[model samples]
Target chain A: MRLSTKFSDTIHLLAFLQVYSDIKLTSAVIAASIQTSPVVVRRLVGALKNAGFIDNDPKNHNPRIAIDPKDITLLDIYLITEGHTPLFVIDKETNPLCRVGGNIQPVLTNIYGEAEQAALTVLNSKTMQDIIDSLIVHNKVKQAKEKSDLAQDA
Target chain B: MRLSTKFSDTIHLLAFLQVYSDIKLTSAVIAASIQTSPVVVRRLVGALKNAGFIDNDPKNHNPRIAIDPKDITLLDIYLITEGHTPLFVIDKETNPLCRVGGNIQPVLTNIYGEAEQAALTVLNSKTMQDIIDSLIVHNKVKQAKEKSDLAQDA
Candidate 1:
């Protein structure tokens, strides 16, 4: 029903780093925010490091975003997390006698690839700066609403 | 690692019906081409029927496209098969103490939705007729290559 949350989690990790730039965080701390275990955080952190997006030290859990938040797109995160996997998977084994079965793979491959590319293109347009800004804006609005609600209660 | 293959299989099923309109096929036969079981075939067939893309009867294994192939887009088929499932999933549970964790969902909901819409837009541009055409063309090329190879052997 759902795809992996790694892409979103990766974004969350990076966004947290940007928002709390002054704070040093261990996998345990990041994992709490992601609602996952420290192990998962380390794995994702390792992946981001390999992709040259972040720098980490063994002695310190603190991570620095090597690339600007505005510079990183969801597509970049996706490429690191999902790794060019097909959006649609075809059934490989087919009755060879069926002419359509024998030749449908390549056709679907092209079509599905285009659709996946379209999704990636949309992701490419979004930067981590957009995410961090939206988070800040939404929280401000939420806080304002809560203050208003509390005044009405009083 | 991969999302559901239902979308691709749905396309495959419809393509088979279009290519072999003259042949009446039971689930067993369709399953053979799909390399899946008859039960899986029936389930998919039911989905297609419910989506108003196909008409089938218990007495007759013959199913008709019910709509023009060109008129049916991949988005239509996707809506039927996959039903607007989020392409990216966000982790819901987050540490309340972490400001980023407390408010990341809405931001992601917006971002993920846009990316999914992008994919659907591309799929909407494509039709079953396009798939059928590609299948026909690829088969011709493949057959031609086989013949040329045989001639060289002779």
Candidate 2:
């Protein structure tokens, strides 16, 4: 099954907001940071705003994270961005004449629902702060390695 | 986050195989039953066959379920179809200059991995038999409702 990068992109957006909470972020600035277009950033920003994840004023056009990063989980971001859609979509035009085709949608829907709930349970265990903390550690490690490489070169 | 229908289609294909195990099923027949093209059916069938979920004879081109339906979990099917890929894909070209963009991939990857494992836990609790039983029940209910409606019309 092909998975989209929207989920990752959303997280990146949120982490950026959290890390740079002091700065007023614009769509163009976010677009440049995420290596995406301003239109894409605006669309996601709109969704996040609508979902109460972020607050944006039309007059100001600057977006800020509304909820506490520690209070938000990846599951929350997923639900906000993707809505309540199942992880896998069933074909709407499956052949009804065939027994499996006729009955599989509901059965699979139930199964997918359970799987999603399970995934949410895991995601809920982690807060956005957890993600930010890891990112900080990762950046520090990379910086340390870069410094070591420069010292060797000298 | 658009989802692919491959997972549901795969389950439909497998359920059909179990229900009609006595019959020699061809890709065309399966495609017709699943309301998909022969090429699509062949692709999924090939994947399943390679993953040891089904067996196919090259000369005859007849496919049969290689594993007991009761032994095949949705998690197994998910793993086979998706391999070790996370449910969410991380963008490799995210802006490296941005602190969050540079480090978010690994953090999100770790979170996604945990979420997938949790989802697998739920999927593992269910077997092909569970799906088949649900399908059988669904079919019977639909048939009964149809019969009742017909009797009322008469």
Candidate 3:
């Protein structure tokens, strides 16, 4: 199975929100940043809003999304936007005749829960704000390099 | 997006191999345990062999698959078989008119690598053998309880 881009889009959107906290980031703006469609961004934002990862004013002509980057963990955002099913999925029909298959589902479910918890343990250690902070620093360095290059050309 | 049954099937296949190492496990037995067609089991077994996760005889006659469960990590097996793409998926087309859209793919790729690595770090901790051991213990307890229930009925 392939990893979905929705996960990365959510991450980028959260980071952008953190950097632009003073101003509301529209779905169009986020879509531009991620090079995706506004509709896609809106769908993700909807999920984020429902999950309490972000807030928006639908009463406004064009809704503006405000995300509390500090309050949100990557895990929370992941669960909200891109994480739908259990971490590990078992799609095949288990063998009913075998003792193992008859009971392995519950056992595997328990193990998958532990494994997912372990994965989340690492993800919880990171905050969306931290990712945003790093991105801001990266953008600053990039701008500085471009300025230095222009100066050299002049 | 979803976990495939390949991981569990691989584990069960390995355990069966360990138990009947001297004998070749025909697709029939594996299919019986997997509750699928022998053709399906053979196909999966073929994929495992191609990935070097298992070894099969060159002759099609009663091909025996040898798996070193201890040497194989679930992450390794997954990467070989099901881990070909990014961890998350994005289904929408990126906007070509936007600069971010033009660059989003590469940027996401870099970030995806890091995020996937973090995920892999957790998956790396457990091997298929470890899961099999747990299954064995669980199965034994269940069997013992069933036998007791049968005796109590008498």
Candidate 4:
């Protein structure tokens, strides 16, 4: 199965909200930026909006991230999107009479928990500002490269 | 939609092989422990065996883990199972005219790489022996609890 892009889409929505806060936000506009349908964008915005991460109604009204960009971590978005689900799944149909089968689930559960926590810690370490800052840096680099190509063409 | 348990099942298969080494290994026997079909067990065994992590032909021959348990990390299993696929997905169809959409994919890609590496680090920290050890510990705890409960009932 393809990995769901819901988490990344939501992050993009938030970053879009922050980067273009001057424009009156609509699902269509954000969807255009995401290159997905407005329906998908509205749904994502609705999730973040209901979770209080973003402010504004989802009926194509003005939308913006409600929280400080610095305060919103990837974990903050992830918790609402994907982090609540277990990363690793254990086989539940194992024979309880067998020692290995009987005890494997809990052992796996503990290790999966630790691994997910480590991943979440990394997600929590970065703020929305970090994402936006990185975005700006990449944008600038691309622009500079474009300018050099244009100068060479001239 | 659902996360695959292929990795966990492989781990269980290997642990069972190592623990029950005296017993002849068969896919049906492994399936019985995993509470799944022999076909499923064979598929898992085939993967591990082909990867050089386990020994023996997967046609119900004497199958056993080939590597040292302590040397085989969870990452080793995950790499063949889920780790090779990205844990996160980016919206690649984003509009390049917009700064957020234009540069979001690469920025998110970098961040996702970091988060996955952190999770992988935790998975790599634990060897197959660690999983088996935890299983044994959990088994002892359960056995003790069961005995205490039987005495109370008696």
Candidate 5:
């Protein structure tokens, strides 16, 4: 159940890029914002660049969004990073003598693939803009709740 | 994308149970077949038992399937184990000054929930019998290929 923080960090980076499209952002700045190491940010930035999600100019060392926020989906980022890795790893030393153990790998692999595809389908349906809009709505709701609480106290 | 092997191991254990329903299975035996520690198997067995997926008689210390294999889906096992855990975690220390960093957690949580639900839907569509049937098919194909190779060698 424990997954690497790569996907979460990737989305954080992409959302940051979208929100601050006007600002020139560096890995160090991103690392600072994400509270992660610059090396980690640089590594993920490399992946994003390779996936055609971001543009990291060699001359400036500044990274920018390459795809439109409306065009990019969370699933797109998930595939580029975590999606490249298998969801679960089959045990390498399962007892071959057991009928289930001998053939479980292929069965599990097929099932995992189908499950991952289903997840990807859902993620593909949602764009970065959709995430941002939801965030905006959440922020408004929070502000309204706080305002209501403050008024009740008065 | 690296997830814990609990789900895979759970399926392995369940499929073994279905295939060998006559045998009184112990954690040690299950662990041996799964290539995992007995402690790990015991822990998962506890979860499965608590979730009403399996029965562990205290007097015998042996486990048995409580539900019909045809009635149990991978999604049921997923829900009892890995599905209880969050698919992704948000960075708690993200820089609050950054707009996206400040608001990304809720947005990401929402998206992860939807994606997980979609995956669960797919998994729910497949039962343990389906996996066992596929495994049987695979074994036959493998045996047939081996027989053909042996014929050519002879």
Candidate 6:
């Protein structure tokens, strides 16, 4: 009954990857950064890997997944994780007797397909780097405030 | 953890309502068409009603919710059934002791907010009528096939 939280999780992971693009981050680091378990990160990474949205260095013997932040889009992650399912879901068992129910699937599928495409269209507009840039700006603002606090103390 | 199939269900329901806009439908009828339990229809109707997406006849006292297809949008139905959760999901718990985890919440929240906004932008682009139009077209195609089949039989 819940909308999958993976879509949100993927965004969080992407933000971290974008912020730490230069560093080889371990799953533990991502897990820590996101306040989640490393096992969870591994699961998400598997999906992202299958979708070719991320690269994992098992050879480095590290659990870190290297992300090409520039190459990653929110849609890239969403499709790998949450996007495969039709944007709208219908029950496998619909009333067979109702003409509408009998015919609704194909009809609904077409409609949902369009709506989902619309959803993806919006998702495609934002990139991992855009999120990272906002974070950097936030950090700068925080640093500026901290400097002001120190000056007041002096 | 999965996106509830309810939005799809609601849309299907509404599309049928759009087609049968003049009819007073019962939950049993809707459940029959949707091939789900009547209770499920009632539940969805209760939500749709609360969201002001539809009106059930107070006079009929039947187990039906009257829907106003013109006033409803796919986005309205989606948010109603899905609640105001983010389009993406994050873990409920991350290691609180990790500095990254500690900071990740606000950062991720901000990003998730933006990502959700992006998703909403797409979802908001279309209305219920638009979906119905697509459905009607699909039905016409289906009817044409049925007619062609009848002709072949003759």
Taken over the whole model, the C-alpha lDDT of each candidate is 0.84, 0.82, 0.65, 0.86, 0.80, 0.66
The runs of at least 3 residues in candidate 3 whose Cα sits more than 4 Å from the true structure, single-residue gaps closed, are A1-3, A18-26, A56-67, A147-154, B20-24, B56-67, B89-115, B151-154
Which runs of model 5 end up more than 4 angstroms from their true locations? A56-62, A144-154, B23-26, B56-62
Instruction: Give the alpha carbon lDDT tens digit for every residue of B16-126 in model 3.
Output: 555545555788877787787889888877877787767755654444435556777768766765676545554355544433333344554544455667667767777
Q: Write the per-residue lDDT of candidate 6 for residues A40-66, one digit (tens) a residue.
A: 887887777676666654555433335
lDDT of 4 at A53: 88
Which pairs clash in model 5?
Answer: none
The full ranking of all candidates by lDDT, starting with the best, is: 4, 1, 2, 5, 6, 3
By DockQ rank, best first, the candidates go 4, 1, 2, 5, 6, 3
TM-scores of the candidates are: 0.93, 0.86, 0.77, 0.93, 0.85, 0.73
Worst 10 residues of 1 chain A by lDDT: A56-65
How would you encode candidate 4's per-residue C-alpha lDDT over B29-136 as one tens digit per residue? 889999899999888887887789988735545887888999999999999877666766776788989999889989999999998888889999999999889888
lDDT of 4: 0.86
Candidate 4: tens digits of C-alpha lDDT, residues A75-120: 9998898865676677787889898999999899889889888888
Segments in model 6 whose C-alpha atoms lie over 4 Å from true places: A1-26, A44-68, A143-154, B17-24, B51-53, B56-68, B92-115, B118-125, B131-133
Candidate 2 - CAPRI tier? medium
Clashing residue pairs in candidate 3 are A3-B86, A3-B87, A3-B88, A3-B89, A4-B88, A4-B89, A4-B90, A5-B89, A5-B90, A89-B3
- Model 1 TM: 0.93
Model 6, residue B6: what's the lDDT?
Answer: 80
Candidate 2: stretches off by over 4 Å = A1-3, A56-62, B56-62
Docking tier of model 3: it is: acceptable
lDDT of 2 at B112: 81
Evaluation by DockQ, superior candidate among 5 and 6: 5
- Looking at candidate 2, what is the lDDT of residue B18? 79
